[model samples]
Target: MGRKEDQDKVQSVLELLKKQAPLTLKQEKFCNKACVERFLKAKGDSVKKAAKQLRNCLSWRDSIGTDNLIADEFSAELAEGIAYVAGHDDELRPVMIFRIKQDYQKNNSQKLFTRLLVFTLEVAIQTMAKNVDQFVLLLDASFFRSASAFMNMLLSTLKIISDYYPGRVHKAFIIDPPSMFSYLWKGMKPFIEYSQLVLVVSSLDFEESFEFNDYTSYPRVTSLRFDPSSIPSTKLGPCSSSRFSFTVSHSCDSVKPWYLSLTDTSASKVGPTNSSQISLGPVISPLNARSQSFASPIDRGLRRNDNFIRKGFFPSTPMPQKTQSLDPSMIHHPRTPKPSFLQSPALFFRKDYQVSRVEKSRDSFQSFLKFYRRPYDEMIYRSKMKPPLGGLISIVSPQLKRRHMSISQRF
Candidate 1:
């Protein structure tokens, strides 16, 4: 059929599902029109068959508690590392990588394995970008060798994906597959059409294409230096907050400043509402201001009068009101004290000998750079076994020795 006819068929199937299929409100919201199209396409455009398929899927999902599987299955760290949601392909489709370890075995029931697969697929589906609902499955089968039961479980999981999760995985990349995997691939090859499966004998191409190591299989989602939004903290394992290199966003509501108690207003009133009008006082100096009196307070019998202090510092002539305003350039503010570092005048001056030392260091560094830029063959005149130390004595002049001594002393 043509594309338009197929779309009409899908629409008809969706209408039929709404009328006949038994689906909950949650299922109806989760399963969009594109999902019904998948069911119709999987069942050969037969409305009754597609409706039945969707109803069975809904019933199975409800029975197995598929919603809680993501939360419960991630407790297994190995499983999380084995199958994770990588960043994306060039086409912007979500890429899900699954690698089976060589020593891994199914000790539990098949139900657990199935649930894990379902949970992984759901995560990939949820993480897909806008206008892109398909996924590319990158399977590493290097370690999955000579295990018939494990192979059966894998094929069965593929079968479930093909039957229920239609149109989800559009491409499959098999990496470092052994010769035995060809038989398995040939058996299930006919179920999916318009889907391509590539078997790679060498993992080099896979690593280059996806930018991941074969053994480590680190996730590309968080591996990029720029992008930090894809991978969750759970998948990376328990990372301490102190060790994280990226900035974490947090609300300032619970964070109280160190000077909050010293402010004039209560901390509750210091919210964002009064942010425009609040003014902070200058920092107080711990050193006491020098008293004018050289004698101790005990030696002074009576308190000094204000006129006695003014008469000693000010002139007796009547001052104009404008002059009494006090020029800021002449009078220093007693409220703000200078720190000890800025109080010394010697710290601000640069000596001429220090300038000469800096110039000498720069010239030496430039000479070193010029020597470093020369080719190795040009830099080394000839290859010598062990006589270079004795020959260096001929070129060692008194000026060179003095320069060496000066350089050592400067360092």
Candidate 2:
């Protein structure tokens, strides 16, 4: 359709939507031109259908209090990290990642989960660029084992998005989905558009394709250096017991060592002492310790000579001997010798177990391939049985054959 025709249709839909009921300020704000266009596109440019669906969506939103959903209300659900809005796709569409593994239907009610879903959608819509009305959905199913139990929740969520938030999903990807996820996918297929559904091996593929950093992963710690100067001197007090003792070492020799001190609140002498300077014991260098005798024959054999040690060939060091004897309370009976690695069950059966696992996976994948290939084969056979219609069948037959060939080659 021409630009003028599209504008007239949008205006007609907007008028019909406004006439259906007196729109509140929230409903009016929501029924913007962009939203009207989305509904129109979703309903195949039919003004009546778009207006009716848009009106029903507005009514549903009001019933659910979509605009008034506070993030704090779903704090537990948000904290679980099951679903949240983050980043954007290559098309500047906002991305919403759903961690399927974190969801537990038994712990949370269906109503609560629905509320969380609506809230997440609202947030994603709000974060979209001015011209972008849709959002990219990523379902991280790497550790998803409860596909059967989660199917209902997944279907309800997809239904809500399809029914109320039409034309709002740019794409949907299932990342590292397990074999069991096929069942969930079958149930969800009806709600999702065929072109929008994508199965990727990993989230890295999605992030790399979009050229965006994944905020879902834990951030790397740049530095772990702690400044001892941050500790207050007034809080430092004499520790009567040594059980809570801890040592803090500095890189420079000029800096004095600090010890963890616990003050006795009930004690009369609660003043600070020279506890920070108190040494736990003499520290032994690895070189000197390597020269000492070892408790085990394995350690003795692994010990290196001075020439080899100086060259950094063998870095193994023996345990240092204590200057003091162990108290009766601190002593324990000697431990029994550990069995050799060759005699262990883990080492004995690991190879056979791994082979069996590989065989099982191969069998399952082959079965999956057969299951996936049957439909295309049937389609091609059916297409062949049908008589040619204006040579349309000829064009479509090659496309189907090529598609099947490509799918086979991909696997």
Candidate 3:
């Protein structure tokens, strides 16, 4: 369809939606021209279908109380780095990364997972660049094993995105997927409308293709701000000794490549130095020195305490202590052996005990029957039991039962 025709269809769909049900203030803010256009494109430019979908989307958003959702409510999930909006892709579309390895099936609650998914998408939408309505998804499946356990959650999330937030996924890349991931993709392919947009690539290919620089770092919550002016002036650099140990520069420009820069002075040195030779002394700041000192002993390559040797290590085994030699006279004679079961059967079994093979077999069969029939027996007994006289009287006439049974007991 031509651009003008598409615009007309979008407008008609918007008018139809309005005629069907008046949008509230919140819905009005959400149902913009872009949103209507997305729905139209999702519904094959059919005016009635698009309007129906928009109505359903609005109703779903209202039921979930989407307007009231806040990032603080999902702080735990966000902190785990399971899902978050980070840097943008080569297309300038905001990228949302999902670390499948960090998702624990034990802690998975469908409701909370849905909320987290919606919250992450909202943040990604807020961070999107102008004229970019869709976002890129990076599924980091490295070392992820419990795909079957998470299939339900994953399918539900896909359903929500496809049904409500149509045309919002520009592309999805599965990074470093395990061997078992092919099965997962097979299951997910049916739910995904734009299968061509989903690609499976190695970590290296993802980095080179997407140009995502900070893939390893955790997303800063401050980056979710829609206004660029609210962002900090300086971006955080890579950590050296500890998480807090990072270099800061005044300029907001991207860092220069190490190969391009002849000297390392720009990264380490505070000011121009006289010596032509590269120096590492100035790189260690007072804060970095403290951080290094407080760092883990294993990370710092320091020897662990002798008392804290690792389990199964050579040093952890107990050593034999010195003792005097034992003499024959010091050793006591061994206790007399007990009578065998065959020699003195009376000691083990009761005096009146009798073995009857037929009785034993019959008892076993009877026990098995009882075990299987217990539930049916209980149901029959319950059916035969009479209803309380108070309840019967209340059903026939309340006044007659009121004198016999108190209200609390009758209930």
Candidate 4:
């Protein structure tokens, strides 16, 4: 249909839904399938089940501290939440809890409320018996939200650590776009100040910013990209050190590149309670789902604090070649010997030639070109031959010379 027809269709749908609304005593709010969808989060036959689930979520809102069954802690009634969906404790549920609401004419939307997330996380983390050193926090690409929420939660959490435990907690963030906004990283400049380390992960292909363009000395942060294309200069203007890193995780079919940037500056600004960022990338389809090696957001947050979200380098085995065939084991189980890219052929091969080095050494082209200019140079260099000392004319002995001369004369 044309523009006018499309508008008419939209208006008609709104009117139809409005007619079916279950209005409240207060005139401001109207309810319908959309509101019910938001409340129960139902898809398909799960509407009845979702209604039950929403009741559970609403009733529980007590202390969000270090308790394994934090939800249970709030109310000691019946049980079973995450496992009902992702059998064997899929962490996606709680991680979804941290989600910035997505806005539609019916949706709420994306703003990263870090403490908002951590409030739930503190319960997850503290409830476990694992060593603090063993935990690594992993974040998935939350679509249409700013990292400000994530960063604020991270820095404030770190500030808490710095005040009490000092270097006890370490955090890393992964940014995947079309799914997320880029500017969400604003106030995150100060994380390196509180924690011993920080890592910035991106779904773009170029090198990502670990730190913004300012500091170039502080250690403990790694910036990485997730694809093959060069990341924009504005995203990663400078680094805290030359030791900053890059990590690419897309499959052959994925056009999107991964990116990362590092900074050593400290974050001090009180960003916001709701940081709904609107920018987003193309959605990750189930077909290319395996192309990404992202963890179950909940498990990465609460259950498994493993290698994928470490203080060191991101793994180099490379995200599995098959994008959508991700192994469930990989998501939930932490790798014991985390792989390194310093030994990867891709990383090594690329490092051998970067734009800056190629441009800077243009003057040495003549010396290099000389090898190709003279065909004889190949034989000389191939044999590792050296010129005679002092430009002296060196030749074969007279006995051998006579044999060579006879052979040459005949030819």
Candidate 3 structure quality by residue, lDDT tens digits, 79-190: 5666665556556676677764535545676667777777778767766778788887766667466565445545566788898899998766555666776697787787
What C-alpha lDDT do the candidate models reach, one value each?
0.53, 0.58, 0.60, 0.32
Judged by lDDT, which candidate is best?
Answer: 3
Better of 1 and 4 by TM-score: 1
TM-score, prediction 2: 0.49
Candidate 4 Cα misplacement greater than 4 A, ranges? 1-69, 72-134, 147-165, 177-196, 204-411
Tens digits of per-residue lDDT for model 4, 213-242 = 322221222133243366453442223333
Q: Superposing all C-alpha atoms, what RMSD in Å does each candidate have to the true structure? A: 35.0, 24.3, 30.5, 39.9
Tens-digit lDDT string for candidate 2 (227-316) = 567656554334444223344554335456566644333242222324442232211223223323543344333232334232345767
Q: Which candidate has the highest TM-score of all?
A: 2
How would you encode candidate 1's per-residue C-alpha lDDT over 24-105 as one tens digit per residue? 6889776677888788877888878987888778878887777655332444533235665554566677666666564544
Off by over 4 Å in 1: 1-11, 18-22, 78-80, 102-105, 147-150, 187-200, 204-411
